[model samples]
Target chain A: MAVLQAILDGLMIGGVYAVISIGLTLVFGVMGIVNFAQAEFLMLGMFVAYYAWAWLGLDPLLAAPLAFGVVFLLGAAIQRVLIRRVLKAPEVAQIFLTVGMLIVLENAALLMFGSGFKSVSTPYQTSSLQLGPLFISVPYLAAFAMSVASGLALFLFMRASWFGRAMRATAQDPMAAKLMGIDSDRMHMLAFALGVGLTAFGGAVILPYLTVSPTVGAQFVVLMFTVVVLGGLGSVAGAVVGGLAVGIIQSLSALAFPIQLQNLVLFLVFIAVLALRPKGLLGGAR
Target chain B: MNRSTLLRGLGLAVLLAVAVATPFLLDPRGYAIRVVCLALLFAAMAQCWNIVAGLANQVSLGHAAFFGIGAYTSTLLLIHFGLSPWLGMLVGAVLGGIAAFLISLPTMRLKGHYFALATLAFGEVMRVIANSWSGLTGGPVGISVPFAPPSFAMMQFKETRPYYWLMLAALVVVTLVFVAIRRSKLGYRLRAIKENADAAEVIGVDTTRTKITAAVISGMLTACLGTLYAQFQFFFDPDTVFGVASISVRMAMIAIVGGIGTAAGPILGAFFVIPLEEFANDLFSSRAAGLSQLVFGVLLIGVILIEPRGFMALGSRIRRLFGKGGRP
Candidate 1:
């Protein structure tokens, strides 16, 4: 019963994990360079939502689009100014450039917001629904619902939109995509923006349950990477599977170990995955 | 010796003289000397990183695991059994080497980003263990080295001059190792592997064994430096030592900024980066909390943007401009 309940709770939170990590995999898909600063954008999304709730009395769910919009622009600008230069550089340069961005974003947030944890007070913050022998936290359920909706919307956009086709084309082959009249650079900027925007959207939705701080992104860095690696680097469908698996793994490990050692289990799994399956369990595509 | 070799030898002697004489010129207890000491230590750490990353192109982002292992092993030994840090350093090196070997066995086949990601997770695992295993690591509050009478045995000294010299010696030793490796049969094999691993393998290079050897050596050297750091600072926590940004990224950044593959690169990088960072911290700590770190991030970005090959390339470019038409 406890194991079943843990799995249930895991799925709820895992939905958000999937949404947050999709951006990471997406950026990797479009641009071979992994944005180490991807989590910082999630932090930014949380801040945006926090401010929206505090100043405008809007719920974080309501403010999720705003967070996405703001971060999307920031992501686009960053891609143009910073990431573009490193596109052709060596892997070391690419890695460090993103790391430098990570440091900059975290410090900039620290300077702007100070080193304080900010939380939102929602009416459903402490509420829960009992399901026979199991229970569902309202915040988790709401966040999960938001993640599913956004994820579905993203799927629609990818399958139905011309821009999505162009992005996918670019990811497949830049020269071929360019010959097909798709602006590869524009696709890159769009993909980066859209990727981080989705992650920021996840950040906004989870604001009711999780506190926002400058260093909050540090917490998710390894977790997100684990998810992406498990699902495969560039595969969107894989991130969903990876995220749920990670969430379940975390919750189950919580059941077995002390709370402090929870991340230790995750880190071990991450290393094991990377060591054994560098292409990811689901196999990599774009 | 030829003219260039003689000139290089003369320059090194002059640099060594300057280094030995620097303590007398500055206030022995001053912050500047402390910064210089830290710079030397970091340079050694970066040099260790360069042996693998710069030479073999196997960029590791989790060196802090070995660093933290070194610090904790020595400090714990001191607290528990009254073992001298000198002995503790040797123990730490052995353990670090073993840890490196264990990690390398599984991850030796991985390359580039996959290798980096695996190593990163490895470092975080060490940090989590250290933080949680409070009985051993003393938890997040951190551990302080017990103050004993100023002595060489404990690796503790009252004056900063000894530490500066110790760090300089360490830098020299690690730099020598780097140069030796670069000139060795192993060095040529590593370069071949770096250029094309599969091709090297086809030509009879044991790619896995060579990579594992480099990683173990790098890890062991980094651990030794960690002991030096433990003695220098006298207080540390898992976060500070096993920290991603503080130890891992900083070491890699130093190597990258100076010149990745060169013997002089980490030294050049450490001298440039560490002092600039200290100056930034001094200038901005009072104004804002994260301002100094922000400056660090900006500087890293600036360096990457200006020259991905780092200061070594910039130096040659300037020399080429000045020596145009004078040399072949």
Candidate 2:
């Protein structure tokens, strides 16, 4: 019964992790560049939700799209000013710039927010739905539902839209896309914006449960990176599967072993998976 | 070749003499000695990182893991078993090297960011263990070393000067090894792999063996530095050991700014950036220290934007601008 409870809880929380990582994987797939600042987009969303709740009495769910819109523009500007400059440079330069951007955004938040922890509160703080002996908290249920809906929307976008096809073509072959009269540059911008939008949306979805602070992004980004790598670098489906697997393993392992060893399990799993299958579960074999 | 090499050696000797003597001459006080100790520590670490990151072209963000491993291992051994730090440092180095080797075996297959993330997870795992393993690591409060007069056995120096000299010794030995490796057959293969892994492997470079060798050596050196750091500060904690800021501040600013691959770059980087960082801290109030980090971050961005190759490349450019003249 305890194991089952842990599994249910893990799956609910893992939904958020999957949403966060899907954004990361999508950006990497479309742009072949990992945006280390992905977490800052999440941070921006949480802040938007917090302020909207505090000042205007707006619900967090309603504020999420607003956060997504603002962050999308921010992401587009980042692409224009910084990433575009390095689009043709060597891989190392691209990595350094993105890492630098990560540092800059993290510090900027620290300076702007003053390192205080903030959170959004709603009416369903302690509400839960009980299924026999099993229970699901309201925040977790809402987060899971939003994640599932967004995942489906993302899948549809990829499978059913002209812009999505253009993005895919750019990912598959930029030169070929250009030859076919698609503006690969515009596609890259859209893809980056879309990824940032996902992170923003994720932030708003999970804000009620987790506290927001400048450094919170780092903690979550580390987990998201683990998920992305575990899933395969640029596979969205892999992220969804890997995120839940990691979430279950992490939560359940705490029950079976020392709580201190929870992270050890994750690290060990990462090593094991890398050793056995370098390209994650859904990743293309390299 | 001999003449230029001789001149280079003389110049380097002069620079070392100045660094060694600065504490006594200017009496910039023990604060300067403290800075030198830190700079030496970072130089040693950056060199260790360079073996794999620079030479082998595999970036590991968690060299701090080895540093932490060495620190915690030696600190725990000394605190619990009353082992001498001389022996402790040796044990620490071995432990750190082994940990790194084991980690790399599984993670090295993943390219680029995946490998980087794996190392990061390894580091976080170490930290979490250190914090939760109450009996061994003392949990969040950390362990403090007993102070004593300068002694060979304890590796505990009474004064800052002795610590400076100790770090200098480590620095010299590490630098010599670094230079020796750079000129070795293995070094050539590492360069080949760094430049192009497939080409190197096709030409029979044995890239995996070379990367592993670099990692072990790098880990050992970093661990040695960690032992020294604990001795200098007289304390060891999981935060100091495994802190991302601690490693990133040193490696990212110094190594990245100095020149990622050059022998002289990290030293120049330590010299320039560490002092500026200290000054930035001194000039600001505690509450406003974030501004210093902001400035530092901006400086890093500016440097990256203007000169991605860093200070060494700039130095070469300046030399070329001087019409290849001998030193004025």
Candidate 3:
């Protein structure tokens, strides 16, 4: 019964993890460049929602779209200015450029927002729903619902939209996509903007439960990588599967280990998964 | 010797003389001497990182694991048993080598980004352990080296001058090791593997073994430098020693900005980055908290965009642009 309950709780948290991590995998899928700073966007999103709630008296759930919109524009600018320059550079340049961006964003946030951890007070902040032997926190459930809704919207966009198809075509082959009259560069920009925007939305939704700090990305860095790697890098479907698995694993591990060791468990699992299957469970590319 | 070789040898002799005399020129108890010492120590650390990352093209982002291992091992030994840090350094090197070997076994086959991510996880694992296993690591409050009577055995010194000489010696030793490795038969194997792993394998380069060997050496030397750092600072914690940003990235960045695969590159890089960092901290710490790191990131991005091969390549680029015989 305890195990089942843990899994239920894990599912809720895992949904949010999937939404945030999909952006990372999507960027890799489209451009073949891993943005090490992807989590910083999530950090930005949390700050956006925090401010919205504080200033406008809007719920974080309501402010999620505002977070998405703001980050989408920022992401597009970043893509145009920084990431686009590294499309043809070596893997080292790509890795460090994002790393540089990570350092810059974290510090920039520190300078702007200071180091205080900010949290929102929602009506459901302490509420929980009981399902027989299982208990679900309201914040987790709300975030999960938001994640699912946004994920579905993304699914529809990818399936039914011309831009999505064109982006997929570009990912499949830039040269061929170009031949078909699609601007590959434009597709990359769109993919990057959408990718980080989705992560920001996830950040906004989870703000009721999680605190916002410039360094908060440190907590999710390995966790997000673990999820994406488990699903397979560049595989959106894989990120979802990996997310639920990580969420459950984290939830179950909490029962046995102290909170301090939580990230240790994730790190070990990350290393093991990478060692065993570099391509990930759902396997993105060769 | 050929004229170029003769000139290079003369240049090295002059550089060594200047290095030996630098401490005398600077105020013995002053801040500038300490900065110089730090630059030398960091240069040695970067040279060690260059062994694997530059030569083998492995580009590890987790070297802090070995560095912190060395630091904690020696410090613990000294605190508990009054053991000499020299002996502790040796022990730390052996342990660090073992750690490198252990991590390499599982990750040797992985390439590029995957390799980096795996190693990064390993470094964080050490940090988590250090922070949680407080009984051993003193937790987040950090550990202090017990003050011993000023002595050579404990590797503690009262003046910045002796430490500068010590750091200079360390830099010279590590640089020699780098040069020797680059000229050895193993160096050829590493270079071949770096260029084309599959092709090198077909030619019997033993790519896995070669990479593991480089990692072990790199890890061991890095551990030695960790001991040097622990003694120099007189105190440290898991975050500073095992830090991804402070130790690992800085080491890799120094090597890259100076010259990734070249002997003089890390030396050049350390001198530039450490002082620039100090300058940034001095100028911006009060008004803006993250400006130092912000400056660091901007410099890194600028370097990569301007010259991915770093300043070594940049020099050649400049020379070629000026219509010299240097290759672009």
Candidate 4:
């Protein structure tokens, strides 16, 4: 029963990881660039959610769209002004630039918000629902629900929408997308904005449950990277499955070993997963 | 061998003379010695990083893990048993090298961000272990050497000048190794791999072996520096030993600023970055505690954007200025 409960809890937390990892993966998929600054988008999103709760007394869920909107514009602007200029440069320049952006965003947050860890005070934080020998907090359930719904909506959009097809075409071959009369540049910008929007939304959703701090985004960078790599670098579905697996392993490892040693377990598992399935479970041969 | 080479040798001799005279020229206080020692240590760390990152094209964001491993190993051995740190430091280096080897075995397969992420995870894991492994590491509070130990066997120096000279020697040794490596066939393979791994592989270059060799050498040197750093500081906390800021970003930044692939790049980078950091630290503390890091952060961004080629590139520019009769 305890094991089952741990697994359930792990799955929900994994759902949050999935949401975050998918956002990062999408950007990489479309742009052939990894934004080391993706975590800052999440950080900015958390701040948006926090301010919305404090000033407007709005629920965190409803504030996610607001957070997404702001971050989307930021992402689009970055794509237009900074990333687009260096789109043809060596990938390392992009990596360094993104790292630079990460520094800017993180320090900007520190300057603006200070180092205090703030919590988004919500009524549902304390509430939990019992299911057979297991218990689930309302916030965790809500987070899981939000993640699943978002994932489904994103999946459906990609499958059916023309914008989504253009993104896919661009991901596969930008030149081809251009040949097909799609504005590849616009598609790239939109993809980046959409990706940042997802990360920000994930941040807003998770803010009620987690602490919001200037350095909070750093905590997710490793786990999110692990998820993205394990799911296949650019595969959306892979990220979702990988995230859940990693989450369960991490939570269950706590039960098996000291909490401090739990990360070691995750690291070991990460190595094993990489060695066994380099392309990830859902990804084609990389 | 040539006019430029003769001039380079003369310049090195002059620099060596200045380094030898610096302790006497400056105050003989421990704090000054500490700063100088730390600068040399950072130079060594940056040089090691430049091997894999600069030459082998593997951006390891986890050099601190090796540094911490060295610090923990030497300190733990000395504190737990009556082991001499001189011998223990070598053991520490080996252990750090082995850890790097283990980490690289799988992670080397990962390209770009995945490779960096794997190393990052390794760094965090090492830090957590250092923090919680109370029996070995003394937990977070950390282990310290006894003050004024009876023998040189304990590796305790009576005066700051000795440590300064020792660190200077280490720096010389590190520079020699970097110069040697850059001239070797391994260095050529590294350059080729950095340019294009697939092409290097097709050309029959053992890309994996070259990368692993670079990583191992880099890890060992960094660990050796870590051991010296622990001895000099007289304390080894997990935060200080395994600090991502200290080990990863600092060394990488120096290497980046100095010249990523050049033999003299990281040394030049360390020279500028350390002094600049000290200046910023001195300036910002009274005004704002967090502002120094903010300034450092901004400077880092600006440098990457404006001058990714770094100081070594600028050194030539300076030389050209003199060559063009523009005033030294």
Candidate 5:
């Protein structure tokens, strides 16, 4: 029963992880550059949602789209101004440029919002649903629902929309997509915007449960990377699978180990996966 | 030797003379000398990073794992068994080397971002362990080097002058080692691997073995510096020592800013970055906490955008613009 309950809790949190990590993988898929600062966008989203709730009396779940929209614009600008410059640069430049952005974003937040941890008081914050032998927390359930909705929306966008097809075409072959009269640069900007926007959306949904801080990204940096890498970098479906797996792993590890060892468990699993399946469990070149 | 080489050699000798004479020029217990000592210590750390990232072309982002290992190993030994830090440093080096070897076994084939992430995970693992095992590490409150009389054996001193000299000697030793490695057959193998791993393998270069050797050496040297840092700071925590941004990125960033794969690059970079950081902290720390870090971030981004090849390339670019005696 405990195992089953852990799995249920893991599934809920893992859905949010998938939503957050999808942006990372999507950007990598399209641009072939890993955005080390991707989680900072999540931080920004949480702030957006927190402010929306604090000032507007709007529920965080309702503020999710606002969070996504704001981050989408910021991400577009970042992709154009910063990432565009590094498309042709070396790997070190790409890595450090994002790292630099990460430091700047985190510190800028510290300067602006101060270094205090912020959390939202939702009506559903303490509510829970009993599912026979297992229990599901309301905040977790709401976040999971939002994640699923967003994931489905993204799936539809990729499958049925022109912009989504163009993005995918660019990811598959940039040169060929260019030949097809698609603006590869614009596609890159769109992909980056969508990716980070989705992560921001996830951030807003989970804001009710997790405390928001300038340094919150430190907690997710390895977690998100593990999700993407476990499924496969640049693979959207892989991120989803990886996210759920990581969430399950974390929850299961929690049952056995103390809270501090949670990251240790993730690290060990990450190393083992890298050793056994260098590509990922899904096993794709991307 | 070529004219440029001779000129460079003379320039280095003069620089060394100046560095040796720096403590005398500054106050014995002044903050400036302490900063210089830190600069020297960081320069050594950066050079160790350069051996792997610059020459071996394996850009590790978790070197702080070894650094923290060295720091804690020696600090713990001193606290518990009354062991000299010198012996603890040796033990730390072995532990660090073994840790490096273990990590490299899994990460040897991973390159670029994959390698970075894996090593980063390794570092976070060490940090988590240190924080959780409060019985040994004292947890997040941090640990302090026990105060004792000025003694060489304990690696603790009351004045900053002796520490400055010690750090300078460490930097000199590490820099010499870097130069020796670069001139060795192993260095050539590393360079070849960096250029084309598959091609190197076809040529029977044993790419994995060469990379592991460089990583172990780098890890051991970084650990040794960790001991030096523990003694110098008189206190540290998992976050400061095993920190991804603090130790790992700073080392890699310093190496990049100076000149990747060049012996003088880390030395030049350390001098530039460390002093600038101190200046920023001194100026803005009271008014704004993260302002200095923000400035540091901006500088990194600017450096990347302007010239990813770093100061060495920028210096030559300036010379080229003047139509002066440069590479051309």
Candidate 6:
């Protein structure tokens, strides 16, 4: 019964993990560059939602779109000014550039927001629904629902939208996409923006349950990478599977170990996965 | 030796003289000397990183694991068994080497980003363990080197000058190792692996063995530096020693900013980056909390944008422009 309950809780949190990790996979898919600063955008989203809730008395769920919109522009501008230069540079340059961005964003937030943790008070913050032998926390359920909706929306956009098709084409082959009249550069920018925007959206939805701080991104850095690697880099659907798998792994590990060892288990799993299946469990997909 | 080689040797001798005489010009207890010590230590760490990352093209982001292992190994030995840090450093090197070998066995075949991701996770695992194993690591509050009468054997000193010299010696030794490796058969094998692993294998290069050897040496050297750091600062936590940004990223950054694959790169990078960072902290710490760090980040971004190959490359580019104009 306890194991089943843990799995249930894991799925709820895993849904949001999928949403957050999707952006990472998407950026890698389109640009073939892993944005190490991807989690910082998630931090940005949390801040945006926090401010909206604190100042306007809006719920984080209601402010999610605003968070996405704001980060989308920031992500696009960053891609143009910084990431574009490193597109053709060596991998070391690409890695450090994102690292520098990570440092800048985190410190900038520390300067602006101070080091204190921020949380929003929602009516459902302490509420839960009982399901026979299990209980679902309202905040987790709401965040999970928002993640599912956003994930579905993203699926539709990718499947039905012209821009999405163009982006996929660019990911497949830039020269071929150029010959097909698709603006590869524009696709790159769009993919980066949308990728980070989705991560920020996940951040906003989870704002009710998690505290926002400048260093919050550090906590998710390894976790996000595990999700992407497990699903395979650049595979969106793989992120969903990886995220749920990670979530279940985390919850189950929590059952067996002390709280501090939780991340240890995750890290071990991550290293094992990278060693055994570098292409990801599902194989990489554009 | 060839003319260019002799000239380089003469230039290095002059630099060494300057480095040796620098402490005499500065206050022994001053902050500037402390910064210099830190620069030298980090420069050594970056050089260790360069062996694998620059020559072998196997970029590691988890070097802090070995670093922390060195710190904890020596500090714990001194605390528990009253062992000298010099001997503890040897023990730490062996352990760090073993850890490197263990990690490389599984990850040696991985390339580029995959290798980096695995190593990054490994570092985080070390940090988590160090933080959680409070009985051993003293938890998040951190541990301090026990104070004893100032003596050479203990590796503890009251004045900063001895540490500066110690760090300089370490840097010189690591730099010599780097140069020696660069000139050896192992160096050529590493370079071949860097260019193309499959091709290197086809040509009879044992790619896995070569990579594993480089990683073990790099890890062992990094762990030795960790002991030096422990003795110098006298206090450290898992976060600072095993930290991603503080130890791992900073080591790689210094190497990159100076010039990867070159002996002088980390040296130049360390002298440029560490002091600038200290100056930023001094200037902006009072104004805002993270302002100094923000400046550090901005400067790093600026460096990458301006010249990803680092100051060494930038210097040559300038010299070439002038040389061409003068000749014409």
What lDDT score belongs to each candidate, Candidate 1 first?
A: 0.94, 0.80, 0.92, 0.83, 0.93, 0.94
TM-score of chain B of each: 0.98, 0.93, 0.98, 0.93, 0.97, 0.97
Using Cα atoms, each model's DockQ against the true complex is 0.84, 0.53, 0.84, 0.43, 0.84, 0.81
TM-scores for candidates 1 onward, in order: 0.99, 0.95, 0.98, 0.93, 0.98, 0.98
In the range B1-328, model 5's lDDT, one tens digit per residue, is 9999999989989988988887888999788998999999999999999999999788889999999999999999999998999999999999999999999999999988888888989999999999999998999999998876779988888889889989999999999999999999999999999999999999999999999999999999999999999999999999999998899989988988888888888988999999999999999999999999998888889889888888988888988988894656
Local error of candidate 2 at A45, Å? 1.7
- lDDT digits (tens) for residues B222-291 of candidate 6: 9999999999999999999999999999999999889999999999999988998899889888888888
Question: What is the TM-score (0 to 1) of candidate 2?
Answer: 0.95
Report the lDDT of model 4 for residue A22. 91
Writing each residue's lDDT as its tens digit, candidate 6 over A79-189 gives 999998988888888888898999999999998899999999999999999999899999999999999999999999998999989999999999999999998888999
True contacts kept of 2: 0.47
lDDT of 4 by residue, B1-328 (tens): 9999999999999989999999997677746566777788888888888888887778877899999888878877877676888887999999989998998888877766667667777888888788888877788897786454645677688778878887888888888888888889998998998888999999999988888998999899889888888888888788778877657878888888888888778777887788777878888777655566666666666666666777777767778877863655
- Model 1 over residues A154-257: C-alpha lDDT tens digits? 99888899998889999999999999999888999999999999999999999999999999999999999999999999999999999999999999998999
Comparing 1 and 4 by TM-score, which wins? 1
Q: Who is ahead in lDDT, 3 or 6?
A: 6
Per-residue CA lDDT of model 3 for A69-149, tens digit only, reads 999999999999999998998787888888889998999999899999999999999999998778999999999999999
- Model 2 stretches astray by more than 4 angstroms: A258-260, A284-286, B321-328
Per-residue lDDT tens digits for candidate 4, residues A35-78, read: 88888899999999999999999888999889989999999998
Pick by TM-score: 2 or 5, better one: 5
> Where does candidate 6 stray beyond 4 Å?
A284-286, B324-328
Candidate 3 displacement at residue B191 in angstroms: 1.4
Predicted candidate 2 versus true structure: per-residue lDDT over B1-328, tens digit per residue: 6999999989988988987886686344457668777888778777778777777767776788899888877777888888887788899999988988998788665566666666766777778788888888899898897665568788886677777788888878887878888999988988998888889889998878888888899899889888888888888788788876567435755776888778887777877777787778778747673766666667766666777677998987888789674655
RMSD of each: 1.4, 2.4, 1.3, 2.8, 1.3, 1.5
Task: Name the 10 consecutive residues with the lowest summed lDDT in model 3 chain B.
Answer: B319-328
Q: What local lDDT does model 1 show for residue B262?
A: 91
